[model samples]
Target: MEILADQTPLPDAIDERLRSQLTFVIEVDRLKTVLRQSPLAAAPRRENDAEHSWHLAMMVVLLAEHSDEPIDVGHTIRLVLVHDLVEIYAGDTPLYSASTDQQEREEAAADRLFGLLPPDQAVAMRALWDEFEARVTPEARFAKAMDRLQPLLLNWMARGGTWKSPGVTADVVRARKAVIGEASSALWEAGQVLIDEGERRGWSRSGS
Candidate 1:
């Protein structure tokens, strides 16, 4: 039998223009996010962009068994990992910020960060980022649903509104879950369960 070899290009020094890629690694201290619970089992009260991405990566690996839908687990994992790379440039946006101009700002930030890579890498990465943003494809939808669901679960488990620093209400939480419904009815139902229990037990404030 003849052998078929894999062909892949080796990575060389990425060049000067790719310096924009370093923005993601520049460590934006202003990008604070997700409050931590002092007693989070194995990992306690550690909140940062790196930690958030790490958790999302693990969520894709560990909770995938409960997806209730066949999906590319690897792709889901990648999406979660790359989803927030833009935060490096755009900075983290609070979930409940009253500012009416966030969308435009974040979108512009996405352009700057994703546009920094090599043309090919930048295109692929941007497409994946955009797909995650659009939340229309099956993989993208599932990924987005989890992105929202995880914080809510963490806050509830963290003893109520730990991450909802701006004040989260049951109705507001429900509205967040409502979008998940369009993505996956099953996961959305699960979100409802979490939200309902959170409200009943005061993990999230009711009618706040």
Candidate 2:
């Protein structure tokens, strides 16, 4: 068995370009350490940023058909993969937690993390992250849909995972998750069914 370590030496023949690329790749490994509030269905521990991004990428592949408009699945996958790399430095901000400085922290993290790559690759990576943040493109919108839907599914499976938090209610969940409908009506409708059922089961409260 082998472990991945940033200290591993690169070949002497590797140029500065490849060196920078590998450095950026190693830096992103830190995302695995940044955990989120959503718990894994099979485990009590919370999921990490890396796992969440991977899940979104897979969701993009499997659920692109549900998007409101046509989207390039590959591009959307790139959006999901790049979306959370900033959390390597910015850290995960729970969806329900209020944070006035999250955007500021993430922007700084993006600059430092993405800057580790070669200039061209850095620009491309930053572009993907920015596009996802903007949520303007069809792929970006659908990527966001998958991002929101993943946690919603996880919470339902965990019997109101995040919904168990103080002040979280069915209405709050639906309001926060309504963005899912902006990209995928089908998923939003399905999510609404889950929220309604969750409230009925007392997994979540009726109001704040």
Candidate 3:
């Protein structure tokens, strides 16, 4: 028996608008290759930017009620989903490491990546990404909270996840998660419990 294949002619009807959108769709697939420091909850392997974004999006839905202020959950979800798309070019910077140049690099990545879409979509996506970074709007704040929370939750679940790294200390975790309290005191409390537990269990380094 011969192997069968569907031979189809090229559809010339596709236009530049759609071609640009498709190009962007293909380009963003690279986000899966941008590895992050946080490990997956279900496994030991490090998570990637794509997985991190989807995880935060789901977390926003699951934990929306915990936000201290009323937020547009839909808009918040959009923020989480697109917030890290720039990492496709800039790569994931470890949460514990601070780099003065990180924001500039990510801004350039955002400009190039979002620029792949049509003008209106490019503008909308860029705005969402920027809003999340700015953390000014209620939705942005809540989205930022969830983005911080998800990795912490994963670390807790994975028994210290990235906290085992040499430079990661309890103080570092506390400082990094401070924004969670600003958005959701309830979620912040929950994160505190995990941090305390991690310290107790030796999953995180304690202050000497």
Candidate 4:
């Protein structure tokens, strides 16, 4: 008797768009342009787009214990994680970098990056992404605030200032924190203490 032969046959390949899940590879490569860790950390030191997103995601989890407004932690976390994908196209702006045309440039970059998805997803992602960009809603505003707050916290603890490396002042730190603090008063209060201490100790680029 002849040995039985296997009759397995491969299924037809699925196209990228046809599958329920879509690939947004375009955004992935472009994301390399975004920088994190700020100029204060390495003088030109920067974390990649992926690292920056993860840092925000972790902050949502770590800082949850400190939020006072009964925020939707889940949504807040999600908001932070996805907010910065625009950097892939627009690149990360220096915290204190001045620009009259920055907003328009970022909006265009967002359109290109988020527009890569299929129609429905394009709309959904673009909406959430825009929410983070606009910082109007509670979620967007809170997440945006934290976005700035986290890095500042690090620089403060390290006795460094990314913006200060150029010409940032104590007032500038206060102003940057103001936008984020407005989103969550409690977070703002907690952050203020850090700023005060930073100033008291002369926590500039030296972190001393």
Ranking by TM-score: 2, 3, 4, 1
Put down candidate 2 lDDT per residue, 1-208, tens digits, no spaces.
Answer: 1223346866768898888787677767788999999999888899999999999999998999988899999999999999998887788999999889999999998998888888898899999999999999999999998989999999999999999998788999999999999999999999999999999999999985
Highest lDDT: give the candidate number. Answer: 2
What is the C-alpha lDDT profile of model 1 across 1-208, one tens digit per residue?
A: 1111112322346555544345333433224553332224345554676567667778777766666566788998888877876676566676665767766877887777655466777788878888888876777777877777777666766766543445668887787667666656776788888888877886767884
lDDT pick, better of 2 and 3: 2
Q: Give one digit per residue, the lDDT tens place, for model 4 in 1-208.
A: 1111112322338565543233464335445656664533445465676766777888887776665456777887778777777776666776777867767777887787666667787788778877787777676777887787878766764676563566676677878678866666777887777877777777643232
Model 1 residue runs over 4 Å out of place are 1-46, 162-167
Q: Given candidate 2, what's the lDDT at residue 84? A: 93
TM-score per candidate, in order?
A: 0.74, 0.94, 0.91, 0.79
Error of 1 at 129 (Å): 0.9
User: Each model's C-alpha lDDT?
Assistant: 0.65, 0.90, 0.86, 0.67
Error of 2 at 123 (Å): 0.8
Pairs that clash in candidate 2: none
Give candidate 2's whole-model lDDT. 0.90
Deviation of model 3 at 56, angstroms:
0.9
